[model samples]
Target: MKPFPKFARQALALMIASVPLFPVAQAATAAEWPTKPVRIIVAAPPGGTADILARIFAHELQSPLGQPLIVDNKAGAAGTIGVHGLLSAPRDGYTFLLVQKGIVSEVPQVMKVTYDPFKDLVPLAQLTRQGLILVGKPGLPARNLGELVTYIKANPGKVDYANFGAGMRGHTMGVQFNRLAGVTAGAVSYKGSPPALQDVMGGHVPLMFDGPATSLPFIRSKQLKAFAIAYPKRIPALPDVPTFAELGFPDLKEVSWMALWSAPGVPPAVLARMREATLKVMQSPEVQKKIEDLGMEIGSAATSEELARDARESSERQGKLLRSINFTPD
Candidate 1:
């Protein structure tokens, strides 16, 4: 057998010395991940859109991750507080934020948030798209969009509307409706949709822009009249109602989507696993049925790459709209 040169022998010894380190390093990386219970922060109080979505995901995440998913409700500041809290956490995929589309796309433009929605957050998956339903008080004499607009125009500032909260989807829709229709109404902000719906039903507020899930019961009971849905198509729960597009307000049609997001800098492997788990959970028949029953349309979960692209596109579009309206946080 021939012997190697001195430099070659040193190189061979170094390679042999480093042979055991690779597996150890990889195993350590994987082991360090999710060493504790993972936490999903919901930027709203219990029973709201973000909270409900978080619980749904937490239930599904447990089976795949083999770790209990903890849902932390840090509601306030129009979802910015909870979102900022999640962004402040370690970017190890153990912490995530589940929020509605308004927060990710529109709130930043209207509010002075500490974190940049696009730059600080990494997209995970879009779970569902819950279209907003324009509901009027029973016996208010507004049967459809045209009637509602006519009534509002005649009444002017006499009309009152309830919103889930400031800068929320409901509020944004109200603002958009007033802007496009060239009419203004008193906007009453509540903690969540249920309370807002209560006031609307009680005639304290005559109308509201509500998510399908929150307004479906009232609509079915005929306590509230759904004039039009803000999406391109009518919600299944309110098939009889027309859409904004059908009523010549195509620009008002916007789907309120729910998505999961993690802070930037999470490892690619962790993100991949999270994304896979999300898609599987979202596609499950059990989950799908529950989502459908809530008046939400199921959407295909996106990969990290796809999510990134969507975030960029949404941010750009929302920026233009915000600039047009000269919207800013108070």
Candidate 2:
């Protein structure tokens, strides 16, 4: 090889010398990030589980982050609206998404969405977790899962259950349960959990598959009757209730969870800071108590890559579940 010119050699030497400072500068910048408020986009309506959790974490995170954390609800198109909002915002490490597993794992299985979650977003950390519950209006005669199955068989066309959305986890689980029990209940779909829960409480819909976060208070108040929880074991809040496994439906033991994610291309340093802060906040005794009081369990301590793997596994399971029932969304 020919020797470099004098000026070229000097330039090369300078470039090599400056390379190490680049990452140091980047780290310093990340350390001082959130010079302004951070926005957490929730792809669901207010008063629902996602919204409630987002707000709770946002409030708790402000102190640790030294900035105000705001939760913006962009409910529509099965969470695509919120994804778009996050994509459109400035990628200055200030905008992120707090959403349920279904938005990434279940929605795309049946609906055509504008964004591909695996391609467009990055999981940061898992948050709260809760299992789905089979609930009925207080006046319904069915007292438990077996009784409910019997009632559905006897009523036939007269019975139906409300689901938050078509192709959502709740809907799929409800269908799978019916199939396993050899009974049928028509599915009534709504935009989100709040509206569907309202109709179920109004007695317009006789049954619903809902998260414990929203259904726990009603169950305690006697406005709704809990049939079975789709958890590994009975939750302490509703000790009288039994798990699906206890009721002989072991396949319905999966639980739903919420996680934090950001748009692709966020700086690695910023991502690291976020994950650290979030995990620290989640460990606070006060925060854990609050989550438990809402009938939810604290999220796992999984890393970002682990959470991504969990999501992929969940998607595969849901795909098989949907196929087994020959379900095709309209």
Candidate 3:
């Protein structure tokens, strides 16, 4: 080859030197994608099971992301508002949503959602799946599901049930249960289970369909009376409470659940890293015990495809459940 000019040789050497370095810097940036604080949006008010579960995952996630995790509470509109907030944020992996599957699966059916949940939010991991309990105020005229149904039949719209959000698990279960029981009762929506259950406990609301963990304290204290669990079997925490399946409602065996999600189009490498870090956190004995103590079953084995499939199926099923009760948002 012809000899290169002096300036051309210097320029070629400089280009060769830096070509290798840019990728190194890019790789470093990729590895440390979350150099700033990460936010995990909880779609309900604080002091609810979703909020509690989000905090647990957030605490464990800090070490994985190498950045402190912030829990952002955006409670309203039966969780639709929070979903809007999540989608409005950039699709960067740093912003995640820690919410119940019901919001994605159950909420969209009753009314409308601005974005397609499955398409807009990429499923990361399923954290916990557990049964919700049906509890009534301490002085509701009925002691069991049968009596409660009879009371509702007799008293129709005079009684009300509390739910954290419209079209969520508690809402769907309550509406479904009433349909199967052949009764009519009104529902009151709240920002979270804590507030809704509080109304039930204070006798402001007649009954509530809520998470086992959120209602456990009140059930233990006798502020709220546990009528029946929405699981296939009874829980050790409340051995006396009969399950809906045991009480002749076989279709009521579904469990309420929560999952972690990232905004759409997260880099594949970052997605894999997130999956690995989450699985690590989930596999820890301490985290498992902590979740179990909260009356939730760990569901870390679920894959993203499975999560998405389940969401679609469950949304249709819940839509039917709501329709059976003639439920339509006003």
Candidate 4:
């Protein structure tokens, strides 16, 4: 048989080279997936929104993934600990971190963290968003945002507000309130919202900025008076209560969000799967009602690419805000 022509030889070589790459790519894609239990690291202790959402998501993902979904709470250091834990895990899509908006956006700006929020992690999806409610003891004079602002102005440093921690979302809101409303208030920190809320309910602290999960039950029982929600629009759970914008402080609107992220370098296929699983869980009626009942609004489902972009934008904005305010971690 005559030897192959030059063009045919080149074509044969190209086909041989392509054959190995196909299986290599297939193997990489297959190995990129989770073959064991996947852990979702929550940045707060049990009973908190991050933890609760993680558990719900784990349950929803288990059946589809054919693997157990575990939640590991590494609460401390303003969520950096949990983030560190997630970062330390393998990047093979078996580990994820459940984080709030503040942890990704604000905490890094104020604190020195081991991992860069944007560079070290890949965003999966934003699961929920909720407005914080400003609440006070039932007998306090403030009934709405206006009343609260006026009272704080009159009282100045005398109006004390308890928060989960110094640099937490609640405390950040307090700083914004003081800056915008031109009123000074004392910030008392607690280990978490439950204890801080306890202080508020017992009249030890007259005011507090609390999440709906912690504040809603009290508001319903008439123990705590709901002032105004820190959101652009009023939430249906507290429809009667006005938003801060309605009360003339549009800049005070802040919506807390919970999101899922994986360590950077997780394969695109794995990340896509995670995003799909998270959106599916959040869209379910049962999960929707549970989140809504907790006083949070379900977030718009986002693709992995969209979530990654949001994380970057939020981090940049938060860095600017913190630097402008000269905020430093404690």
Candidate 5:
């Protein structure tokens, strides 16, 4: 993976920062909206990245809406189960998905789903962006990123990497890793993270790309090895682990975004209030502290158009990567 040239990186930063912070929409006062509790659909299990961050944001977002924000875990089928649940809810702005962008960007490229992300849900705000960590079993011969590449190439398809599902982030990362790292490790797909991590800890699968919240505890416990983070910058939570760009893979500097969106048919004013309250929560001191504790940085994309653009870009990139690997899953 090649890192972007300095000028390209600078140009991208400038372009993103230049976008206006808000979209032009008629906003209702928060007081007039949310006459009842709001439910945030967390599309993954209770402890996964989506679930953890959604809960935290819900905790902070409740203050502004003057209503309870419930983090509902409707986890299954690569997050579409919860998303399907949203189709039945009245599009009154009281319900929306609080999920990772990959659920929209990557899942469709890999499996059949009941709904279209672009049609069924409306984009609202992007909360935080962070990198994924490539962790290996401690007993593996490779001690670092370079050695891990060398070892995987030497062993060819003998080394196994875990993916939570066929088209999920872990699977996308694994595909990119195989192409960028120039290795051939067989993929071991699981129903979810627990079974995958169980195998990683048991040494059945030697490598995986995981979020910091779930894998950090095992890494610190010496149950798994940290190879590299999937971003351009090193994270404070895993300061000892170098990013892919730091180790010479410049093209692998993709980060994951967590976004919130109202179900389709919500009134524009309701959507505006939801977006306003979310942005307010992101800027709060308590929320910032909690985000730092989770080892993430606040993200931009305050407007729905901006967020939709980012997700589409991500999906395009993921599609290209999948093509490079000749991936086709039924």
Candidate 6:
């Protein structure tokens, strides 16, 4: 091939110099990421634990990210709607999901969903893990799990417990508790925690298996009576309460966690940047105190691979519980 003319060659050299090196340009873009507002999708409705946590994290993360973080509530269908919304959003790292582990692990096993969570999403960081609390309406005669079991046996067909949803952690725990305690209480499924909790508080439902996020306030205010908590140890927020293990039902000590996830295919640099910002915010003493006050434990500094493996193990355990109960969606 003939060589380019002198002027043309010089112009080409100038053009090449004007353009940034690809690696440097990419690093810069990742560094200045989230130039615009970002969104965090919550799979549950307002007033629920997940929504509250999402708002808290969003508010705290804005300063570190240098952009406003918006929380989008896409509730319904056992969290499938929110999961779908996250998967459908742009993989540009501007959109993310703040959801409970059940949404990806337990929900899909029982509900019909369009996407596979492991394949469609990548974990950024775990936000928090909370244990479930068994609470009763103020008027209930039972003050503890033992009394509750006696009451349930006495009432037989008349007694029932409220669960946030079928295949959810609360429901699973309720079923296991019934079998282990040798009681015959049935489960009443609600669309979300708020409604279920409201019914229990109203005395329309005598009991509910709920997360501390929503139940703690009522229990503290004496609107609801604590029976048993499903944590391995008693939480600081409710130190007076006995754990399920303490109540003689060690198998009921299952805890559910929440985590942040990015859409699949988000660039590695963007994922790392986002994860770093999230972990920094989460590790702060102020943030940790805030989460603990809400009756949740701050998540570990687990990487995405570690988080995924944990999720898979949680899914397997939930699946076994579902199979044992022969659970079917209604």
**lDDT agreement of model 5 with the native:** 0.82
Q: Sorted on TM-score, highest at the top, how do the candidates line up?
A: 2, 6, 4, 5, 1, 3
lDDT digits (tens) for residues 1-330 of candidate 6? 999999999999998997878778878877789899999999888877788889889999999888999999998888778888888888878889888777778878877777886888677898898899989999988777788888889888888789988788888888888888998788898877888999999999898899898889999999999988888888888889999898789888876789998888887888998898898899889889989899999998989998888888888988898988787754
**TM-scores of the models, in the given order?**
0.84, 0.90, 0.82, 0.86, 0.86, 0.89
Worst 10 residues of 5 by lDDT: 22-31
Instruction: Name the candidate, 3 or 6, with the larger lDDT value.
Output: 6
lDDT of the candidates, in the order given: 0.80, 0.87, 0.81, 0.81, 0.82, 0.86
Model 3 lDDT tens row, 1-330: 889999999999999888889768756766878778978888888877888888988898788778898999998766777777778887666777888887778767756778787788767888887888889999888878888888989987898889877766777787778778887778888867778877888889998888888888878888888888888678767788999989889888787678888777776667778788888898888888888777677775788998888888888888777777677854
lDDT of 3: 0.81
Which segments of candidate 4 are over 4 A away from where they belong?
Answer: 1-32, 316-325
Q: Give the alpha carbon lDDT tens digit for every residue of 1-330 in model 5.
A: 999999999999998976653342224333377889999888888777778789888888878888999889998777788888787898777888887887778888888887886777667898998888899888999888998898888887699889777766788788777877788888888887778888999988898887776788898889999988888798877789998988988777788888887777787778877888788889888878878678787777468877777788998988887787688956
Q: Write the per-residue lDDT of candidate 1 for residues 58-154, one digit (tens) a residue.
A: 9987988889999999988778888878878977778888887677676776668777777787768888886788898897977778878898999
For model 2, the run of ten residues with the poorest summed lDDT? 321-330
- Residue 100 Cα positional deviation in candidate 1, in Å, after optimal superposition: 1.6
**3 versus 5: better TM-score goes to:** 5
lDDT-better candidate, 4 vs 5:
5
lDDT of 4 at 11: 100
Q: Lowest lDDT 10-mer window, candidate 6?
A: 112-121
* Candidate 4 residue pairs that clash: none
Best by TM-score: 2
User: lDDT score, residue 310, model 3?
Assistant: 86
C-alpha lDDT of residue 47 in model 1: 84
